[model samples]
Target: MSGQNAKPEATPGVRQFTVAPDDDGIRLDRWFKRHLPQVGFGMVSRWARTGQVRVDGKRVKPEDRLAAGQVLRVPPGGESDRPKPQRRQLSQDEIDRAEAMLIARTDAALVLNKPPGLSTQGGTKTTQHVDGLLDAYAGDDEPRPRLVHRLDKDTSGVLLVARTPGSAAFFSKRFSGRSAKKIYWALVVGVPDLAEGEIDAPLAKQPGTGGEKMHVDEENGQPARTLYRVLDRAGNRAAWVELQPMTGRTHQLRVHLAAIGHPIVGDGKYGGQDAFLTGTISRKMHLHARRLIIDAPKDSRGGGGKLDVTAELPDHFAASLEQLGFDAGMSDARPVAEPPRERTPQEKKQAARQHARQYRKARRGERRTRGAPKPDKPGKR
Candidate 1:
């Protein structure tokens, strides 16, 4: 009932606010959490149920997605009695640390090279994490950056952060749809028998581990796939490999490599004691998310091009590569267009037969060529 660009207007104890572009595509309840933090979800639902909340003059549910330029009508009086959370004040050192991890930044995204040993998000006993440091990147008026994906605490690599709620939804869709490509570099204890192959395994959480650990479960598990290529090998002791996960699963790469008898170096949780090397190699995990390529929000630029970024290896990973006589530059860490599909048994047999037929045909042609008298060299007879 009012201009879309105008600020929240209040009249007769009722308030109307137009959704900002940064809040686009999020649930109505999430919108409250971001802009109206004092309002609890239960209150929002109750208001929605009683037709007190309206969008563009129609009743809307709490889970309904909001679009930019939509006007929201509110009946007010939903502030919770509990004390609101106080935003943590970041120290100068924390600000510096967060800035140091930043590798690339755009209007819609922040690409960070998170180091090993730092958690992506805080946990019960975790006080410091990448999520806590995001406050340093935003100003009072800017939307807080949100994580679209996560990396293990010990696996260092390129981590993507969305600059706004709209971008977060966009990036999350790309990741969930498997359109975003992530390439990782790892050092394993033993070389794989095949130079390149795919691991198709189903994974589920181990029951006794309180959902903290994952294991391969053929009968009841989510499908997981990984494509790996051995770049270089130091005899049978170690090998540097490139890993691309076709499906994002918890510890997929680590568990798959271990299942094939070539456990990733320093991944003791999955590989046990065999994960360590005896020599000068660092004990820290050697897995690094080398590169990420994903579609960017069309509104950020001119509706084309993608965000392609690479992260430098951590100090320990680099040192271990040198100690193992492996060259990090050998592989360019390119993203594959699509995951290779496994061939059926019949298809494999058909391919083998075709190959043998072609070989025999070539041999027969060679024999005929040799048996036939060579053409008399240029009228020699």
Candidate 2:
């Protein structure tokens, strides 16, 4: 609840905070999370991680103990508020209820069935985020494991976390290298023509100030690849689809689907009129980060070798299956289609021009047949 009601706005953009008498020696991130839960520790950590969170105008680690009169400045960290684990506003009972769903954990990571509306992390002035309750999630570790990747703040399902920097670094590298394959379950606004296929389009950040707003440049953006197969189509209105993001980009799957005009439900930002959050749809933003498979980096501790971990779909995601018409309990979410080689700009242009020429020929033939009599009028003489 990023202090939803707090008027003590964090310095807009990037503001610096000075350690005060009441805040001495506390971990910088903890202190800030106490004051700014909405801004999230991901922001805090990225700054601190990169020596951007400065103390006395000097960068310090988020774990560094803060002394009184210390000044900390948060550098600009792009637009997507880096995530952190934040404490939720759930009560003791609510917390207890939410516990049965801890789906997976390992020495290197933990995954949770993040419920819709629960944020992954909190910020200074934010009261509760996944990080706010270190005692609960971090366990015996002095500092809790940080998030390696994030589900959208409102999305629910297998959200992964890294227990230590060694693991975080391992997975982070793997994520950057595209070694992790992600599969998602989503109910989209309408049925697609091809039952199973690929959406090869360039996705560029929407050129304005908003988180997660991206566009299908199909032309100028970075190459983003997504492969989706229609699992079930409930008439002309909706389809249950499984998506594999062959390339990792922010909202790649969402953008790809929407570019084809079948936006996912509940994706308020990019799903356009089909966003379930908006009036055009009624289903829960039918999207889930249903599965994650990582070819775990070779164990650095035990002579580099490969390790792989896989997460099955959570219940809600599976339940989404029954609604959308799949064998609700099957564990496999992999797409059946092979990805096509992406056409380069020149090739795509050539194809388009070719299509246009064909279209013009067709139109010309139609005009010659349909409009010829009106034009000649037999010379009307």
Candidate 3:
């Protein structure tokens, strides 16, 4: 019962506690789980329903977010009878593997250079993943690091993890707000016609793929955009490119590139047989997250400055780059200042009106020049 988990002594039957800074922005049920581990979620829900739980004298729901310094009131007697769940212990090898991925560490965050083929979260058949490995980063008294964002299983690169609940909320906001910037390096099947351009296609999950595959669907889709710059081309076979996703759509980069007729090398899910490259190129996906730049939490010991980091390319990708005669150093992997925001209908209409006005003024000037009295024949007059 150290840190913010320690509750103040209270009178009989009822207990009162103040929301702590660490628990701020977390749900009420999460607060109970963190501080009063004996109280189950069902009990918390019942308490809220029966008006036994109150925050600042108002009945609060289990999903209500807690703010720092708020006073909480609770009725007693909701300890669970069942044994508490035990966390799985990691072996030495697992700990080593988790530590190996660490590229940058701070009081608020840990940045890992995730290797390919490792899933960010566990799925139905996925027992081992980056989430499960996070226990290795925490000590017995430390809060477990939580993932703020995700990368595809085959897409290797920098992944951010928040070390505390407050930091988790902080980082999540930056990501959702589009304030964080990420740059990716990829090898595509063919060079694009335009060396540098933006892909403004909308994306939707393909109907038959059970939401696992995405495709361009202008009629019914979410707006998705990606900025791509070709670094170098190895004849017509392959090209090295830098990619910056303007939107966080699932499989956005893969789908957009594939839709434009150039799929990343070895992205069989989107490109099928055409995704593969011949001669010494590994069949693993060639996309890798290269750099991430984001603001640190306010309470971070590192003066709350930006956390900028770059991950080295994975072995297969590096080997492929060398084999293709493409220089990885040719391009600096800097993210664009901002993603291009889509203009509203009113703004578009205004722009069109202004263009029409300019066109009409030019036309009137041309008519006046043609009608002028021919300048009286100059010297002859």
Question: Taking the candidates one at a time, how many backbone clashes does each contain?
Answer: 0, 29, 0
Candidate 3 deviant stretches above 4 angstroms: 1-20, 25-30, 40-78, 300-302, 333-337, 344-381
Q: What is the C-alpha RMSD of each candidate to the true structure, in Å?
A: 13.5, 13.8, 13.3
Candidate 3 is scored at a TM of 0.76
Worst 10 residues of 3 by lDDT: 1-10
Off by over 4 Å in 1: 1-30, 39-66, 69-84, 300-305, 333-337, 342-381
For model 2, the stretches where C-alpha displacement exceeds 4 angstroms are 1-98, 123-126, 141-143, 275-282, 297-325, 330-381
TM-score, every prediction: 0.76, 0.59, 0.76
Model 3 over residues 37-130: C-alpha lDDT tens digits?
Answer: 8899999999999898999889999999988778888887899886765667999999999999999888788999999999999999998799
